[model samples]
Target: MSGRLQHKVAIVTGSGSGIGLESSLLFASEGANVVLADVNLPSAQKGADLIKDRYPTVKGIAVKCDVGKEEDVKAVVDLAVREFGRLDVMFNNAGIMHPEDDNALNTEDRIWDLTMRINVKGVWWGSKYAVLAMRQNPTDEAKGLHVGGSIINTASFVAVVGSATPQIAYTASKGAVLTMSRELAMVHAREGIRVNSLCPGPLKTPLLMDFLNTDEKKQRRLVHLPMGRFGEAIEQAKAALFLASDESSYVTGTDFMVDGGLTNAYVTSIGEPTLPPPSSLI
Candidate 1:
């Protein structure tokens, strides 16, 4: 509604469902041209179609991307630049919590590798490609376009704290994402790019709800939530909107927690731009 991302071009990965879809729609509503990327082509296309149906003024395109593959990651960024002429935001939001991933002793090597490839390596490839394009972003003073952009990677509350439930692979991957974001933020700060990791708390998403089918199972996690309510996808999307917009121009390299007071410990840390590129918080 604020049109904070007006005329900006953004790529949101894992945009087929969950919080990714919510952010894509929110971005479009804020006057951004969105490129919805997912391994599932149809779902990503649906997001694009929804954008076309509701916000006809902005452009929406869908691309099939498996974040685990470097080529797929590069291709999507290329498509965004080719179609929109520049990339303003890159949200490396795609990740997996493999059901098979559990306690270290029980979790198989195959499962760990698979989870790492998509969760940790995916964000890495996504960031690598994002920085490449953001460096070449064309400047257009009239439209408020600049050469640098924002990069957001989706982590989780477990990244900063321990989880007795123990999705070890997933927890480890998110930790990597958070640390990697901080390092990337500093490396490219002078180049005018901002990078941050978004950590969402327990959510009441369909996937999570289905998993927490019983009240006993639900309360097991809810007891830790001071809010006593599971977070909604929109809440996480809103936090992401902040990271993607110029409002967070000076905010980077930190864990942008949307965890509803689930965890208090935060990793503190940021960039330059026509919108005032991020400044390191160190």
Candidate 2:
């Protein structure tokens, strides 16, 4: 498992915190030089600093990037090439689910537009520049490098299944992400690049918890989560690592769900144990 991404260079957007930060740390541990891009300069720098202090051998740089901006995304990719000489993984993990993103009727035009810009358009920009960089630095087989790279888009289970608690804009944006990933995968499949959508269920990230202030609100969200708990960022990072590494070389145009069975559950377990206790408990 060590050095699964040895000698690779990766850019993880929204790396200040949540899944983005966790994945950047994991990728560095596996021997990839990482660029932590975030709109928050100080936060991105802190994340990069953590990696540099811990994984001294790997190069970690913090770049101020707004993924929603094409120029900013392009700069992030260019930074990876300028600093590391090549790009191998592009993790489009930056997104938003605002309080204002409820139902089409209630959600404002501004909120909807912002959500689409960051969640959907951001991925488009990241993929656009990453593909160009990856193609230019195609695998050097003699040097033990592969022929192409991996692109991981952070989608959500909401894209696959409908929810009564509607975040209309967020859900629709993610739907775009799922379909866009598939189309891009097909376009690049013959070119040696593999594209995939990593759909996470309810997570304990700040993005989710910030909205769930009360225990009642939390319980309402957890009712559908079969695990009876929200997923940790590190858990999702492991899945991203698999996609970034050569282990999933043949995987493309797929919706990889790491949802803790939430999506599979029709009626999740009730408050307590659903079945009788074992004899040992008795």
Q: How many clashes show up in model 2?
A: 0
Candidate 1: the clashing residue pairs are 270-280, 271-277, 271-278, 271-279, 272-277, 273-277
Candidate 2 regions with alpha-carbon error over 4 angstroms: 274-282
Give per-residue CA lDDT, model 1, range 90-141, as digits (tens).
Answer: 9999988776777889999998998899998999999998999999998989
Q: 25, model 1: CA deviation in Å?
A: 0.4
Supply the TM-score for candidate 1. 0.91
Q: Write the per-residue lDDT of candidate 2 for residues 175-225, one digit (tens) a residue.
A: 999999999999999988899999998889899887666788787778888
Q: What is the lDDT of residue 135 in candidate 1?
A: 93
Candidate 2 residue 276 C-alpha distance from true site, Å: 13
Error of 2 at 149 (Å): 0.5
Please list the Cα RMSD from the true structure of every candidate, rounded to 1 decimal place: 10.0, 3.7
